[model samples]
Target chain A: MDFQPTEERRMLADMIGKFIQNDYPMKARLTAGTSALGYCPEAYSKMAQLGLIGALFDEEVGGFGGSGFDIATVFTELGKGLVVEPLNDTAMTSGYILAHTDQLELVEQIILGQKRVALGLIENGADYDWSAPETLAHQTGSGWQLSGMKTCMKFAHGADALIVSAQTQSAPGISLFLIEAAAAGLSEHSFQTVDGGNACEITLHNTPAQLLGAEGAAYPLIDAAAARATLAVCAEALGVMERIKDMTIDYMRTRKQFGSVLGKFQALQHRVAQMLLEIEQAQSAVINAANDLQSPTDERNRAISAAKYSIGRIGCAVAEEAIQLHGGIGMTWEYDLGHFAKRLVMIDHEWGDQDFHLIRFSES
Target chain B: MDLNFTEADQAFRQEVIEFLNAELPADISRRVHADLHVSKEDTEFWHAVLHKRGWLTFNWPKSFGGVGWSPVQQFIFEEECAAAGAPRILPFGLKMLAPVLMAFGSKEQQEHWLPRMCDGTDWWCQGYSEPGSGSDLASLKTTAVKQGDHYVINGQKTWTTLGQHANMIFCLVRTNSECKPQAGISFILVDLATPGIEMRPIRTLDGGQEVNEVFFTDVRVPASNLVGEENKGWTYAKYLLAHERNGIANVGISGQKLARLKRLSLSQKRRGKPLADDPLFAARLARLEIELRNLETTNLRVLDEFSKGAGPGPESSMLKIIGSELEQNFDDLTRRALGRQAQAHMPEVFEPGYNGPQVAPQDMANQSAAYFNKRKVSIYGGSNEIQKNIITKMILGL
Candidate 1:
């Protein structure tokens, strides 16, 4: 299959890449390290205003480009910027659901970056078993009551709403619900992730909710959505990996040991080469998955699992090797390698860890 | 965006499959499929068949008597051959030397060598690696000094694979000693029948004489035998090495081996259970399969670029690195599948008709030898270490 993006997509990439280079520098990235919202809110709006949120959706849903490569292109640029905002939570998951739920009003707000949304899918000890969600949703007339705890509800700290997946005690399967951040009986304790973003342990006690899709049949949607999230994170991780590699290579070229650059040594060169092969392998998997997005469910799952497995393993490798190759300076906070490395490792752990994806790959 | 082949491509694939099934001798196919020893006559016979069909030098351009297939067509032909268990087209003559000749050889040299190379009259061997020059190949010490009308060549070349079957050799000789290491070299074609030359078999770790050592003591060669200018062998040598590297990423061969490994593992038992059923083994098998797919895609990408005449810059080295490593992995797994049977390295069992050793089945007995031979895949082609250096220089600019 052709790997080259179309002219339109390339222009989109160029714009986004230039934006990251011109606006989102190390200072901008580091400023969000301790911010109250854990990111630059103005920058978030600027990203949405630049059509990133819309670029990931369709014209029917207030945007233009929504292909797999389109999403990959956007995330790759975001990854290079080390953009602290959670696009996986806000756009890929919540925005996806809102677009599919026939909620054009909410989709318009999201595309305008006037509001934010997060998906509450993770539980503390669920171990990535998304199909068997523990959050309960009970029907009350036309509305529903959601009562459960979602751990690490990314971007929910200051979001307009949360797209929560819950099991129905009466219907016997999981369903998707749109719950407002101000919904009654809902509480959260927000905390910072190691990678410089905010997430919360959200507890909902019969929180009023609006159904987003078919009741008791949201498992497929949840699976597909989570798979998309995994794909997005992988693309982002690849972007971060390239940046780290460039920084490490620069250090190797300039840094001297025994009156020669460290890069002249065969050992470090081999390590870098190994890192590149892993990155290529991981990239091939993501591209494969991206193309398979419109294929059958089995095909999609197989590709997604393979991509996640490769990215998780390789992302961790580039992360650890980028630091070790940089020597003592690699570990210090002032160096951006540590930050990007942190993002890489955290990305690996977020969707599915290496071991999890390896076994899942076998099963898939 | 489109992966499907055109109607013509599909027809070509079918034609290739049908021809292979009809013309490939079963005995040679059986030997290749099982990694069993095949006689030189068998290889020559298959070579002659392809030569007659004008498909022997598949890598060359149509102007040089090649089939002129597209990169995709070349890939399809190779994959089908590997799948059909056809013996590999020996690289020394067709894949390696022919390209160099087509590029830089004089008109007389091309007319004399290319035809013979295609018709199986000239079995060729490469004389690049010396006793002290492998990865540091530029420092090769093989010397050739010009006399009145001839050049006297003297030095030793090691690891000349299948040299015993070769009647011709392409060598890198140091024609100028005062210049830099790479600048002083020259490429020369030598006839095996020349005086002052001797060949001796070097038994490899697998107890096979597939390689040899050739020593020269003032071997006289006509000065006109030089392919290009004096002190320019390094350029042609590098060109040939790039071609060799492209073949090292043997995706089709490895894919066939993977299929065989899975089949054998399923039939073979480990601790009273089928090895394929073991989770640990299965996971590794699946992982290997996944990496193979990745490499296949990567190869396609490289070929796509090459089809556009980019000719696989630094990426060939990456393929060489991974392709060799992947082969070793497959060999290691094959040995593991053999379990204790791999310990029996009876050389007689490797003899074509020897059925004496019954402790291990013939196919199982083949694993250790194949594994040992595959160990050199990474070491021989400039070594994976050198490949990594190439990658760093090309991709990382370091």
Candidate 2:
């Protein structure tokens, strides 16, 4: 029944929260988001120096605090500031895959922010299915040769390596392969994401790849990593929703029309109350999913799907409602709430959207 | 009692379609339909094409160089233009300012400006919303002090759509601070090239610089540019707002977007089947279609009243609210149908001669940005909340 975090996790949250408050103003975040690398490499390196990235990994792999609550605590703060770093791809998802494959050295490097690794699982038509990737890997004498197109590889433009899932010619199931970013036969078209992050459409033409784990057995691990990533975004969405709600209330309290502040009106007050209620519900969902991350597969999947679905649905409502309440200012680029709203809606577009998870929840 | 278009109206629609097919540039139509950027040249070219055909000023009386089409004919033309992906005739001059000029401006002003508007000599942008005043526009603080033959305008106006491309701006400025906020305001036209007037682009959430903030540092304008009596701007502003509210519904654009959305959904796959076939997605599209249908009917009803010589009343507020919400709904569904593919933000794809790779769906490179951009529909032009408030007071008699 205890809902509070441990003292260590609370300290972790406080440190990250303070860092965001001090170094990550909206203007700075905007600059970083549109920077050459699509994020502040210096700030990321600083976060690593602060031991923030290491907190997402287990001690066996690199550092302490690999629990779901650890991921939630770190990402919720990042989401509050709308930080555009590739932590979810480089550390959370690819780090999990590397750690599970006993690649402790690379995992340690990622934990220290020395290497950035992006996960390439989604294909053009695959939607969310990681079990039967269209990307193909052929067995070679020295290593493996991969050929496929991976779309929407988040932060792929800046990654040192990519942990890509592909179907093997010699096997019937999906497998994980680590490919260098500069490998031959690899081409990428990088573009900024709608949420101010960067992504690339990676086309592999017999690109060299090193298999990490057993062939034809990458599905379960891929599914697990996806669940973890999904939970991270859901937690992040909870953070985004909270910020939107707060900004909206602040707007209502100050913006005057008809000789009175908008908040004084009962109609607006009720909608703001509804936004608060939805945000609280989203918070509970994140907590529940975080707690269930280490549980059995079905239970974990169910909780994650429910949470993600709630976030995907409720996050949009809150984002749209916040903009409507604030009017033109909410739609402006200079205003901070608009960015939060953009991140919130685009979060649903990422990991998996509401429709994707609704189907998953029903099946789970 | 018959709901279908009359035979003559159908023939008129066919004529409009043929005219668009012949005159509308293929590139412009393709770009418009794809939601890509149409250059100022393209817009002006199309505006000139329509003006030459005497169809650009369809809303005006024939005596004022208008084609003077009936309401049904206007509806048919607009629908056909939307379906054919014609560049939207910029509403600032042709719709908003022209009506006010014809209604309140002196014969000299109308004679000078109306022809320039039709001839594409001047690109006009509205300067109504200020940084301090959006929903409550009367609270604007931009001042217009009369100085002999010219008025020295000094203040800022934000959310001026497409002002960067404009040579002229119609603004609401404070003429007298002694009176009530609404009473002291005056609507005045100013040449944007006037000294001390600086227009800085205000980037929207979609990373587009379509709107601007115009700062007036003692910019001077001719006092004769005032549309009507001094300090009577509120009356003219309200009149123009009500007059233009019916078009804010944008029923034709929604229909066009819904069609594009359906095609996108069908092209996108989910588990070996078209995303459109998925029951959940199907239900959403179906619901959007139903709502659009209801809105179309309501809009036609409004136009029906207009044909009988009735001005757009407060019921236009209902159309604004529902229409903007429906268009936003189409955006939501379009993005949803793309899933993570919509995350691709290659805005340059909309640029002419952009041969870059499309990481997402073809012609949908900006779906996410468009979704983010369309949030302005509910926020601007007297925000939907303000429309609701108007409905509450004026229509519901609350």
TM-scores for all candidates: the values are 0.53, 0.97
- Point out where model 1 deviates above 4 Å: A1-364, B244-246, B346-357
Q: Residues A238-332, candidate 2, lDDT per residue (tens digit)?
A: 88887888888888989887778999999889999998988898998899999999999999999998999899889999999998898877878
Residue B66 in model 1: lDDT: 73
lDDT of 2 by residue, B1-398 (tens): 88998899988988998898899887788788766556788889989999899988887878888787787788778888888899988999988999899999999999899999999999999999886688888898999999999999999998898888899999999999997999999989999889999999877788778888999999989889999889999989888888884457788888999898888878888877888888899999999999999988888888899889887678778888999899899989888888777787777886779898886777788888888888888988888888999999998889
Compared with the true structure, what per-residue lDDT tens digits does model 1 show for residues A1-364? 5778899888988998888888888878777744657788888888888888888877888789776787888888889878887667776678877777777888889888898888877663213456666788888876799898876666678888888888887786788899899999998866555466776668899899998877888887777777778888888988998898899889879876444777998887999989888888988998998888767888888888888888877886687567656643454455577778767766755666555577777886
For candidate 1, lDDT tens digit of each residue in B1-398? Answer: 77677788899999899999899987678778767656789889988898777777777888877788888788888888888888888888888888888889899999999888877789999898786665568878999999988999999997788899999999999999898888999999999999998998775534456777899999999988899899999989878777653456899889988998888777765435677876766887998999999998888788888888786477888899888789778876775555433433344454668655233344555665566456567767676767888888989998
Number of clashes recorded per candidate: 0, 0
Instruction: Please give the lDDT score for candidate 1.
Output: 0.78
- Candidate topping lDDT: 2
Which 10 consecutive residues of model 2 chain A have the lowest summed lDDT? Answer: A124-133
**By DockQ thresholds, what CAPRI class is model 1?**
incorrect
- The TM-score of predicted model 2 comes to 0.97
Name the top TM-score candidate.
Answer: 2
